[model samples]
Target: MVNNKTCPGCGVMLPNKNLEFSDQYNASGECIQLYHELSANFIMSPDVTFRTQHAVDAYGAQHSGNRVKNIRTAFSLIGLYLAVEREYTGRQVQHAHMELAKRNIKWSSFILPIRPYALSVADVLNIVEVKRNEMLMEWSKNVWDTWENYHEWTRNICKSYLKHF
Candidate 1:
C-alpha cells in the first residue's frame, strides 16, 4: 500500500495507506510527527524527570563518583547480556574482562576532557566511537598484522573455557 512519497522525518519511503489528510488544522500528519515532537521536547528540556532523578540517586549511592558510576553501569549491563544470553563463562569471562579493561582505558582517555559536563547517552556513544577509532588507528600501525588474530585468540579461549562447562 506504500506510495512513492518519502517520510519527511526519517526520509524513508512512506506507505500510501497510512498517510492521511485531516481537515482539522492542529492534527498531526502522522504518528512520526508526534514522536518527533516528543523527542524534541525531551532533548530541549534541561530538567530531569522525577523517575530519572530517583534512578540517578540510587545509582550514585553505590558508586563514589559520577564517571565511575556511569561506566560501571554500562559494564554491568553488558555483563548481564553476555551472561544471560551469550552464556559466557570461565575463559570467556576472562576474555571479556581483558576487553573491558582495554575499553576502560580508552573510555578514561576520552572522558577526562568531557568530565565537567553532564553528558547525554548520545554524547557518551560519540565519545566511545571517537576513542575506538583512535585505538583502531594505533593498532593498525603494524602493517603485517591483521584484526583476525585478536578475535581468533578470544574465540579459542572461549571454546576452551566452554569445554569445562
Candidate 2:
C-alpha cells in the first residue's frame, strides 16, 4: 500500500516522504517541501524577468485559512492580485508590498472559499522544464481565482496604498 499525507491547509496529497511544516499555516511538510523545490527552480533560473517573486505570495494565499495570521494572509492576497490583475512582475509586487507597509493600514481577513484548490505545487512540479514559468503563472492564476471573494477588497487596497501601481 502506498502511504500518502494530505496537507490540512491546501489538501495536496503527496507520498509521506518529508517532514511537515510546523508553522501557523499547518501545511503538510511534504507540500511545503515540494513548494521549496519548485521555488528553487525559478529562483535559480538564468532568466531574470520571470515572475519568481509571485510564487511565495500565490502559494501562501492559496494555503491560507483562519489559522494563518490575518496580516500574512492579507499580504499574500494583495500580492496575488497585483501579479494576476495588474500584470505586475514579481519585483513590482515586492515594491507594492513595501508601499502598502508604509501606510500601516489594517487589513481585514475575509472568509475564503472552503473548496480545495484545483491545482497545487504538485501539479507544476513535474511539468516540462521549459514550460515551468508558464505553468507557475497558471498555478498562480488558479489560486488567485479561488480567492475570488476578496478581489474587490484586494483591488481597493492596491488603489489606496500603491498609487503608482
Candidate 3:
C-alpha cells in the first residue's frame, strides 16, 4: 500500500504511505533549516534607519551618521601592515592586492566575504584574545608553554612586518 510522495528531507520522491515509516521525511530538513529560519526573520523585520524615507516621514528623523569609520581605519592599518610584512618576507604583495581588486574587492569589501572571509577583524581579535586568556589561565600549570612559544613566533612575524613599515 505504498503511495507516491516526496521525501522532504532530501527532496526525493517516495511513497506517501512509506513516509511514516521512513527516517528522512522531515519537511524542515537540517540542510536548509537554518537558512529558512534566517529568511523568515529577515522578512518580518522592520527598517529602522533614520536616513530612510519611511523613518523620516514617520518621526522626522535626522541623519543616521557614519558607522564604519573606525572599522575602516583599522582595516587600513591592517592592510598597510600586511603589505609591509609581505614585502619584508619577499612575497608579491602588490600582485595579491591587485588580484583581490580584480575580484571587485577593494577597500570596501576586502574585509568582508560572502562566507568564509566574511568575518570582521573584530571577530579575529576576539578569537586571539580568547586563546591568549586561555593560555594565561593555564600558564601556572605549564600547560601553555608551547602556546607562549607560538606567541613569540607570531611576535617575530609582526616585527618583520614593522621593519618594512
- Please list the residue runs of candidate 1 whose C-alpha ends up more than 4 Å from where it truly belongs after superposition: 1-68, 104-165
Superposed model 2: Cα runs more than 4 Å off: none
- Candidate 3 per-residue lDDT, tens place, 2-79, comes to 555542322333334432322221232232233233334323545232111111111100000123332232222333
- Write candidate 2's Cα lDDT for 67-151 as tens digits: 7888778888898888888788888888877877787677676687776788888888889987877888898898889888888
Residue-wise C-alpha lDDT for candidate 1, range 1-165, written one tens digit per residue: 445544331223334446553222112145234333434543454533211222121122112132244444333333323333354442354455456655323222112121221221222223453363233222222110222223343345445434442
- Ranked by TM-score, the better of candidates 1 and 2 is 2
lDDT of each: 0.31, 0.80, 0.27
Which candidate has the highest lDDT of all? 2
TM-scores, all models, native as reference: 0.23, 0.91, 0.17
- Candidates 1 and 2 compared: the better one by lDDT is 2
lDDT comparing candidate 2 with the true structure: 0.80
Can you rank all candidates by TM-score, best first? 2, 1, 3
Clashing pairs for model 3 are 3-16
**Candidate 3 Cα RMSD after full superposition onto the native fold (Å):** 19.3
Report the backbone clash tally of model 1.
0
